[model samples]
Structures are given as C-alpha cells and as structure tokens.
Target: MLSRLRRFTLCSLALVPFAGPALAGDTSAWSAREGTAARLVAGGAQEGSHDGSLIGGVEIRLPEGLKTYWRYPGDSGVPPHFDWSGSRNVEAVEVLWPAPVRFDDGGSFSIGYKRDVVLPLRITPKDRSQPVDLKLNLDFAVCGKICQPANAALDLALPPGGIGAPSAALTQALASVPRPAELGARSEPGIAAAELHHASDGATIRIATHVGNAATADLFVEGPDEDWALPLPARETGADGRTIFVLPVDGIPKGADVTTARLRFTLVDGDRAIEVDTPLSAR
Candidate 1:
C-alpha cells in the first residue's frame, strides 16, 4: 500500500498531470473524481509480499445505465486509451482487463461493464529507494443511449515509507480478472471447452459453454493483442443441455493467420461470467 497525499485540490489535478505523464510506480489506493470517479491503487505492501513493485488498480464508478468499454469494444464502441506522459518515477504500466458482458445497443453489439469496474494495472518503479509521483490521463467513452467521451486526469503523490491503503472494491475487481486456460483444457470443471477450425479470412472458434437457457447467455472474444480485433461470438445450441458459440475471427492484418494466433473468451451467463485465454487450431 502507498500512502496517499490528498493535498491537491480538484482544480490542480485537472490541469497539472496533463503537462507530462510517465507511469512506473509503487504503492495502494488513491482516488480522483471526474464524470465517473477513478482511483489509483498501490497494492502488495499489505500482505508482506512487498516486492518493491506494485500491482495497481484503477477503480471506475459507473452510474446506472451508463457503461464503459473493454480493451476490445466489439462492434460499435471506442476502447479506452491511457496517456502516461504526465507521470513520473514510473517505468511501465500493464493494463489488465476483467471479463466483459455483451450489450445490445439497437442492433449493434458492444462489450463492457454496465456497473462499476476496476481495471488492474501492473506498475514497475525505476528505483525502490525513491518515491513515485503517479499521474494518469485516461480517455474513454461511456454509452447508454448516446455515446460520449470521458476523461480522468488523476494524480498520486508518495514519498519514502508512504503507501496506499487496500480497498475491498478494488480487491474484488482484481479477483474478477480472467483465469488463465489452455485450448481444449476442459478438465477444469464448470469451464467451457474451446476448439477452433480454419476459415477463409481467419478461423472459427467453438466454445462449449453450459447454460440452462442459451438465449440468456452472451459471449465475447478477444484477439492475441490489442491490434487483432475479432468479432463477437455467434450463439448456437445442440440437443444436449449445453450451448456452443461459434465466433468468426477477422480484423487481423493481412497475411496474419488467426488459427495459430492466441485468442481469449469471456462467457457471460446472466450475472456470472468466466474468461479464458488460449490458441485456436484446425480440426
């Protein structure tokens, strides 16, 4: 946990961090407010696993009927972007995404969170002995009926022996991140078995997700990196009590083969969801 300095006013935060941003830091939770409130979290110093570096969490509060985007925003949504040029003492920031649900806006499909969400970030400091002045400039879009752009310019000041406190909300959000899984690794109970077949443009992914009512379920697929924008999964069912989703992969650059490319899946069953990362291959 990194100690927070609440010395800055909202007016200052809205202006200063925009000057320059470079994020690589250590510490717990620090929050700033905008249209939707955002908090910076410094983690790992609480449980005696003080490895100098910290896993940070950005807690975003979404009002009812409002939604934010995942890294890949499916058919018709803009993804969130971060600018760390305004930060200091930071080396790198790794964005970790939680499982997302598919939302139908008219006829277009989008993937994101309808309620509050916390995005886990891995932060590495340049020096452990030194403190970090963490700043963030996040640009994102929120949609309900009309889509609007949103921004959060947050700041956290920490000195030596300073750490941020742990947050239950942030902790739970981090816990919701997708568990790692391999292709055809169905031995894990309650987990869906995923397989793939080659297609003309890319590949087709089949996921054996068990659900009582297939109509109530939703599926989201992500590509290997942020660049590979795959489409949402198409839902299907068999005579058995299981449901299968066939996703046609596309959006990769020319000459890129999706069969050998890694993929991710997020299956949403009502309020419950699970995420997995694996590769696809021809049957």
Candidate 2:
C-alpha cells in the first residue's frame, strides 16, 4: 500500500517538469501523472462570430474508482485551483463547473467528479484582432483510498476573430454545466423554495425542488464566499410532489450577517441539474 508520505513524495516528483507546449491540434498533449492526467482543449468559434467570449476546457482524467473534488469539497478534500497569469492577449477567463456527483469517502460524503471531467472555460480576449494565447497552471487532488495532490501546466491558442468549428468534446462539456435558474421557478429540475427555520438547538435550511426522483436527488449549498464551509444538505421527505433537503446553518463565519448572505444552491438529480443563487430568507 502507498503511504500518505510516499504518495505525496511521488506527486512532487511528477511536477518536476511541465508538459510540452500544445502543437497544431485544438487539444494539448496529456500531462500524465501516477493515477491521473490532464490536458487543455480549445473549442473554436464559428467564422465571423462575435459572441465576445471563447470556449475552452481543462480536461482531467482519473483512473477508475478514483475521484477529484469540486469547487466545494464537502467534508474533506482540496478544490481545484487555476492560474492563468502566464497567458497573453487575454483579459479574463471564467471556469464553469459541471454538476458534481456525491461520493461516500469513508463515512463522510464528498462532492466531485469520477473517471473524467472537462471543466469548460469562457475566455475574453483583450484584442479581437489578435490571436489569444492561453497558459494554465492547474492544481487539484485525486482520491481513492488516499488523496494525492497533482499539478499540470498546459497551453492552447485561439485564432483571431474566433474562427473554426467547436470541438465535439467541448460541446458536450459545455452542455453538462448547470443552467442558471431563479428560485421558485416552475421548471422541471428546479429549486422551488429555500426557507430557514430556527429552533432552541440551532437553525437549519430547508430546500424544496422539482425533480423526477427524490430518492436519487442531491443538493449542495455554497455561501457567498470561499470563507464559508457549509455542510452538505441531507435529503428528507417532501410533500406536494417536491424533493426536500435540509442543511444546518452551521459554518457561518463569525460576525457574518445571515440576512445579507447570498447562497448558491446546486440541485443535481442524475443527469439533470440546475444552479440557483438567492439571498437567505426566513420561512
């Protein structure tokens, strides 16, 4: 068995040299590690398209039964951190996360991806007249029995005017990202309401959603900022054909105003999911 110390030591050696620069293809060469590998993929835009944003992706591949953490890792694990400071002809980059599945890590539940995932990127260029060069330094963790840290440096370039057809891989990845929805929207697979209930013991949040199967559904909550490490909500019995989840109002930072807090809720039911952002409110 690989001990924790040995796993980390091997992981450190894996990062000694960065992967070579991307060649002619829209996808970069895979940067392979012990149990994981990563590559950057470019989704070219249609000719003469002026959508103002270009699509790209960071693809991470994990061995079967191994996993990686999401933006919020739940009970334990490190979220992926990205650095693009080395890029040229780029103004901003936004990484969009696909819906993550729940994992039973020992007795605790963690949220992340299994097998492989392509985190789609929406990039804005400083000058549309010139090609955009993208450099990515990705830091993430992979876990099975023991979690291990991994890093990859990747590069990709997009032509001026965002020409070329979007890659099929990136198209599928972009489709997996949760679509934004409003609270109380009467849409399938949507959050109906989020109410806060206070008692002598403590406060808990109740969220109601409209999904096909309540038993297989799951909900994840995120506070306004990274400082808030909110606990994963538990599924409970619901009424009126709605799925219910309850989250204890613990993990709020000291002196933080609960009323002013904007919570982000990601509701996942099998292959369907939706993202809802709204202010906290009392029942």
TM per candidate: 0.76, 0.90
Q: Give the TM-score of candidate 1.
A: 0.76
Give the per-residue lDDT of model 2 (tens digit) for 1-283: 1211221222233332346466446777788645488888877653354655777889998899889989888877768889999999998889999999888887767789987899988888888678888888988888887767777888887787453656787787778788899999877788889889899999889998888778898899998877677788888877675778998887777777666789999988778889999986787
Query: What tens-digit string does per-residue lDDT give for candidate 1 at 215-283?
Result: 877777777666666667787885676778887655665667776776777766655556767676457
Model 1 ranges with Cα > 4 A deviation: 1-35, 44-51, 159-165, 187-193, 198-203, 210-217, 268-274
C-alpha lDDT of all candidate models, in order: 0.64, 0.79
lDDT of 1 at 158: 54
Angstrom error of the Cα, residue 250, model 1: value is: 3.3
Tell me the lDDT of model 1 at 273: 57
lDDT of 2: 0.79
Measure candidate 1: CA RMSD.
8.5
Error of 1 at 104 (Å): 0.9
